[model samples]
Target: MRGVGIEVNEEKVGRTMEVDEKSVSGTRFCLLLSPDRMRGSLCLRLERFRPRLGSLPGRRQRVCAQRRSPRARRETSPARWRLKRMSPSPAVVVLALLLAQHPSADTLRVPLDYTSIQEAIVAADDGDTVLVWPGTYNERVDFLGKAVAVVGREGAQVTVIDGGGSGPVVTFGSAEPPGARLEGFTVMNGNYNVQLRGGGILCSAGATPVLIHNIVSDNVANYSGGGIACLGSSPFIIANTIVRNRARPFGAIGDGLGGGIACDGGAPTIVANVIEENIAGGTGLSGGGGIACYGGSHPRIDNNAIRHNVAWSTYGLAWGGGVFCTDASHPNITGNSLLENHVQSQTVEEGGAIYCFDSSSPLIRENAIRGHTSGSGGAVHTSNGSEPTLVLNNIEGNDPYGLVNDEPGVTLCAVNNWWGAVSGPYHPETNPGGDGDPVSDGVAFAPWLASAERLVFVRGWPEACRVRQGGDLRVELAVFNRMPGFQRFWFVTSVDLPGGASFGPLAGPTPLMLLPDGMMSGILGHAIPPDAPTGLWTYHASIGIPPHDTLDHAQFDFEVTAAVQRLLRSRSLDCLFPSP
Candidate 1:
């Protein structure tokens, strides 16, 4: 194929030309014109003679030469037609198909085998995926400015960052829209595990929220939250086993708080996690053996197994064995099993299971508490005018050292606790009462203390039940009437008598406070008024035999037919009714 360039010269149009390269390149048409558009009338005439060139100058060569054309008085400028070989349509279609087959989320993937986790993070663009492979990257990683998803393969031990040294393992501080997501990795060893402020792993005031899962354990915090710390951020600590993290102070008052994790003022959800064997050791004032909730931080500690931890006198004063909620911080302590927790020192003021003070009312209920020890409450204690501590369904063992409430107006109303020696107002044997049928043969009826095992017998009497005139009369009744253990007895009475017949100075119900014998009796003396009328009168009485420690009810009915019968009987009754 061949082509030629016929330069056109006209007065109004610049020296312009057209090139048709179908002969040399074997396809298509070509065109070129002067660089200057002004005085462009002459350049338009050159289009009439469509010239072609066999070879066109390169772009660099076309700019160098420019001359005025004499033919037809044309304006000359630099613009040339350059042509090269072009590919067929079938070849262009094949290249686009290859790129579409590869997988990508509007970005690229970088492996951790050859590069560092921080290097992959920094090199990634927004919306890219950095697939980290299996290996330990023993260094602190910070998500510099990328809003990318940095994930690792499952069972791929790719990025194993430690707390051995060099500050927090990962940090996220950026102005991106929606922060970041961290999943499928084992994060351990650091002064603090994952610290982020807003952007990625927030440690800042308005840094973004974090979602943590899959075992964050054995981490230490010099201040609080040994496993993870969300300073002012609210993170969702969901379904993770946070175990054995210690928070001890090296400087200042080492008031260690929250061994497993300490959330300071940040309202995070600590749900369904097993927080145990965690110690908050202090040299001075420590709190929350398993988890400490302080500083007006209201955290909901629900449905977790907080057991076998020690919040004791590690320092001068220690408190909160299983969980410590103080400082007027109202945490909802519900559905948690707080068992076998110990507050060893009397100097540790409150709560073997929980210590509440300073007007903080935490809802403590439905928890199985046992084998716990402290100065006051085996279960719980409150003080500082913090009235109405709601405690319900907590099991109390006879802990020699248990919960104590020293403040006035502190009401601890406990119910349904299963221990023989529970200290309260009601006696264990007297509860589950049987109306005057007191001989209950249950194990709970045994002596409350080992030293005093007094006999409690069933008092059975007053069966028919009728009385009047204050039932001032006395009667004697006995059961197994001559029992040897019951050597002494007393008369107790109830009567229905007319108003005129007065049983003067009638016997009281407990007049015979102790009846040592089985048979003993007292008189029911009556005074008949001189002008009294006739009326039907009935008398009933019973005997309380203290030896048997039982009441024997016997009914004795008699009608005072007339006033004369009572007057005559009073004189005759002296002979029949002798004080027995």
Candidate 2:
């Protein structure tokens, strides 16, 4: 599109006119005289004559020199015309405002033009992309307040930024803009303040950069924040794997804060991350194995898989195996899976899945909190006037207790949670004969959820199967429904074997009742007899609710080759559970 000013001369009213693409941005229509032969004032009033901004360019909008006949103009009624007359000054001002945005942006290469990532940032201007080739850079990088992007040519698996156990792997302080992005790299081996102090990445002082698709692992910090630390800054952290980082105790406070991530007076968006196996507060006053927020920080922690993290203290008490919040922080924790986290303290500990105190009232909703083992409150503990709202969570399989509230006068609102059994939580005073996980006295866990009907569990032998003939193949199945609901669903299985042979289409009446919130999970397998046909074998399995309604279905296939050629390869597995 040509960047031209409005040149609408009354003598040449039928001639070409110019428009600014940047100025005309809304969903408004403009009467552009097109190159098509359109005559008279009727053409300006016709709906077909109007074109959307940017749809008709300057060259495409050319009016004819000839005029329309009076009879042709009379054929159109006045009701069809809705044209508004406007002065040429507004259109001219809009037409002249058109200029290409970011026309001066360039792409820079790392090691091709610059040897270091920091050097590229020093030479780069705003709106520039510094693309690094796949290699390990044994140094730290700082954005230096530039609104540029530093991306890897390959993904994080091949591109690495090792900090050489010196400082933070990446720094985004100095008041960097939000357009400054660090993406697609593995950042590790960073050590600051005897190894932490934002060991992987640090963004502070109102610096709001974008961090995405990176693997931050194996870093350490003796103070706080072994993976990433935000001090009064809010960054967008998306789809990163932050694992195995440690925040050990060193200072007089002796508190290891946030093994994976810490927000000290910041509100970062932490979403869809795999934060696992990190440790916090070893032999000190420690807590928050996966993430911690304090000093009135309120970050959004959503949809992350935080598992196998530990909050350990050899001397003092530890808290919050998966996440901890203190000092009046109000974080929004939603839709995450906190599993198998533990807290090991010398004196006492609580909240194997989550802990909040000192007026920190986080909203914990719709999360799957399972298999956490703590001193008390294996699922959650709230104390010191903290009033968290827990709703719609799958709170099951915790080791000792669930939802323990120690604050004297605060009753937590914990409704609509699903315990492991239908008999509610095993509280001593309230529910004496309850068979589910236990709960504390002040916690309200009544109206708990159980499968109203049948819960189907069907899993295939192997996700990726390569078995020879005479091998056994199968699918594990289970139906667990503690509620007194009627059985309405059954199993349906079919297998297509090799050599033009197939198994029976089996359907049966199962003992599973219909659960109110029905669940169907898993894949499938089949048996290979000694004389079985040696060709492609495919199978389909499902849980059906009779009358042709399928609750869930899955398809599986055996890696098939010729019977003779199957022995050529060793059938070696990649990370497979071959045997117990």
Candidate 3:
């Protein structure tokens, strides 16, 4: 026979619990394995209450227009019918009473004359719904501690929620546990639109929220967090298009950051969102034209198109044109396309596409960056006491300048990066510039060009690129085809031998061909070492031609991957918050 024992200990402030249980086989369960941790009270409150209805008497249902007598009930028993008619309609009275209390939860159809959504909220309950037709509403709404859904009707078109408020018009505050969700809405306008304070729509104060299939755009912020400000929370800002959000005046006197989404301290998952054309302006130190991070916030920025945004010298000294991270804020940025972001300010000196500074390091990987420029890193810049940045699996186009690491011990390592139109060993032997030009200053002009013969040299070389211990190994190439006409080529791979470590016969002479229109392909081939080394070993790759080809020498540098490097050196997987 099994026996169970329970004990309750009361404390001054709260209650404590203890439990012991024995199985039929005479095994005793420890107090730590008690259900106290698993047992929690679930409080479910109805946003709106509805009353149930009962049957009516035939005497009460009198005959009218096409009438004869009230028939059966009138003929059967008049006295009983009169008694039944005198009885109160409990259902209607109860329903009216319930409706008076929590008005939001009861389901009510949208009135025909209800032109504004704000009016509907004022009349609804927590679980109530408002099915709006295709039209635009220019008003601000505040969901004060209610959980309601406002959805569009079938075939609804051009339905817009234009907030006329000064700052974040549509607000959602949940009084429940945590992790609320909001789906299917388009919001626009206001100085800084769609501001989510404590727990905005689809956001919870203590738990993660889900926001999906929405469009938030064309908003302005005088300080930080231009379009949608996600603060002290982890929410899914997924499958939404956030565009044209701007942080104006450059935050000359304030902590101006995150033009698109300013994540102060919390890490939120921003996945598969089209974040484009957002601006962070400053003559000096304004960051994250599209997205920025500060105050030890690291987010996972993945699978989004962050393109055509500008962060430049409104007054000069603009920091991040595309994305910026400072103050030990590390973000994981991967699988995004950062294209054609311009940082052309008179005082701009750092990164054009990305700027990492002040001991903050992020992981950047598998991103396509093209046509971005700054005085230092035309693609990426790390300055003023920053640390190791990993650059991997990126097609870095012509920006005249690549990476700038000015401090002595600040290591800037890049491998397997397709330096567009630049060739060589990837670094300067003595004092070579970004393009192996040998004369690159932190300011003035960036010399991002290289010849196949004048390979840019990495000072520490293979030390900067390596795989993790007991992990899978990969060899990625960012080969650039420089020839004018149709050209055919391949990659010859090799690995550096440290002490006794060695690898051999790298998949003999694969084939790659490119046309004149500058369309690039072929980043294929998998190198997983079944028995990889425990420490650093550089995998060197070179482009070559088959013995029967005409062109003798034509090849460029490829991208690299160091396991879990910081953000600035990353070529893929950049974002904020937790994602699956």
Candidate 4:
């Protein structure tokens, strides 16, 4: 696909891939993708043996962890990763996959080796890597189903792919694999004139490219998928900011589709993304301001923040301001925060957050659907033989009702949800004194939870290991919750030294609510006696609520050399060299 760079500029940052530190200093590091050598699943680093002659190609080396400088750590906010400071994007390990080192495949640079990005892609092979510098390219690009990787030199902030108000900015049509990626660029100014769908990007014919760490915004489509559209393709869309896109229908009134992302018979994995401020403008019928799944698609939408999107039907009806699924689509909606989304219409507005129709059965679980507004179903609605299941969700603070079912003989299996209060949702015929949000008749709300866990423990790792002789080897767990929710959690860790001595049941200083989208990172660690052991220190760290419920945990080991204030680097490279 399109993205990744092998540039040698300091201010114009390349994708800082982490390779093993063969030497401490006086070494040069660069990354490359060689499909014939790296087994099509790994990225090989090209360490320049002679740092003075970096421009000339020399012998290649594959060191695992690169040394992180203070400036690099400042550029990337979090120092959680032991490898060279990764980009601040979520799941930085999965950004641009420059797979196996091929001897023949080269790193083609935009405006350096080639004039444009499409020319580089055309002249490239399956194992090639196309590097785009930080500049606005006013042309369209297609992957051509090759295994190439294209990455922005300075990430998405400066690297732009503007379509110049023409067709889709990017297209992946020919069935690419998972390793084919498009990363680190801002895609905008895409205007699809005809009803062909996919204003910003299009993926069709079973294409499965990994689209991560990019900004897809300010695009307009005549039909569906204003930001990104998938027709019979299952792309991995992760950690991208998708905003300000629209589906206008060319001043027409009636269209039922997605504004930000639409999947037509595609089972795409959409995770860890922020989809906001997208609009579906129509009159009679419209759906999904943030996302739409129809025609038997089964997308996995997990751990995303979908807010402020609008499904507007000028004077008619609309459904699902956050997500809509129809025509037998069965999406797995898990661990997401859907807030402040709206379904706007003068007449009817159903499903302020989610809607299912015509046999669409989505598994909505572990999500916080809050602050949505609609006339009918404020949280969710089901109709026309749809049998959706809702579990472990915090459904609260919507305008009218929490759950509504329009079709007869179709009971929604909505159970074990927290409805803004310990007393559960307010139902006149069932629980009149319920202090939570309101629920309509024919919707199940029993077996509900007293309180829901506010944050999904995205992941946890040791930011640093506090080590002092005879003191404690305390591990700090930095937990990042991407959703706009709150929960108080504490920490405990157990360390097993190299000599079989046990240390800790160590606890954090105080418990605090990890609140409101990256504001607070939780703490977890172990207190090990440093003077006792010297070989290998294995630690297990965990974070949890006050009494019970371990939210997240990480197990890792750090090497112990000599005991004379020696620095120990971690050997466990799970965060660095993940399984292919």
**How many clashes would you count in candidate 3?**
69
- Overall lDDT per candidate, in order of appearance: 0.43, 0.66, 0.47, 0.68
lDDT (10s digit) by residue, model 4, range 23-100: 422232221111111111111112111233222333332322222345646655343122332233221222221221
Regions of candidate 4 where Cα sits further than 4 Å from its true position: 1-104, 459-514, 519-548, 553-580
Query: Across residues 1-580, which tens digit of lDDT does each residue of candidate 3 receive?
Result: 1111111112111112221211101111111101111111111111000001112222121110111124423544331111012111211222232233224344444445465777876776554555555567677666555445455442112556776546664564343212233444566774742323211122334334455446777777765667666555555566567778776653344434567776665676776566778877654557888887776777777656576777766555677777888888888876565666667666555677788888777877655555677665556777776653444434445365655665565445554444554542234543343442121233222232242221111000110122332222222122322222334454234444444343432322333333211222111123334344344343444444444322222212222233342212111112112142
How do these models rank on TM-score, best leading?
4, 2, 3, 1
**Candidate 4: worst-modelled 10 consecutive residues by lDDT:** 33-42
**Runs off by more than 4 Å, candidate 2:** 1-103, 194-196, 251-253, 452-580
Worst 10 residues of 2 by lDDT: 41-50
Q: Which portions of model 3 miss their true places by more than 4 Å? A: 1-131, 145-149, 153-157, 172-179, 192-207, 250-255, 421-426, 430-580
Show the lowest summed lDDT stretch of 10 residues, model 1: 41-50
Task: Give all candidate RMSDs, comma-separated.
Answer: 45.8, 26.9, 26.7, 14.9
Using lDDT as the measure, which candidate wins?
A: 4
| TM-score (all chains, Cα) for each model | 0.48, 0.62, 0.53, 0.70
In model 3, where is the ten-residue run with the lowest total lDDT? 42-51
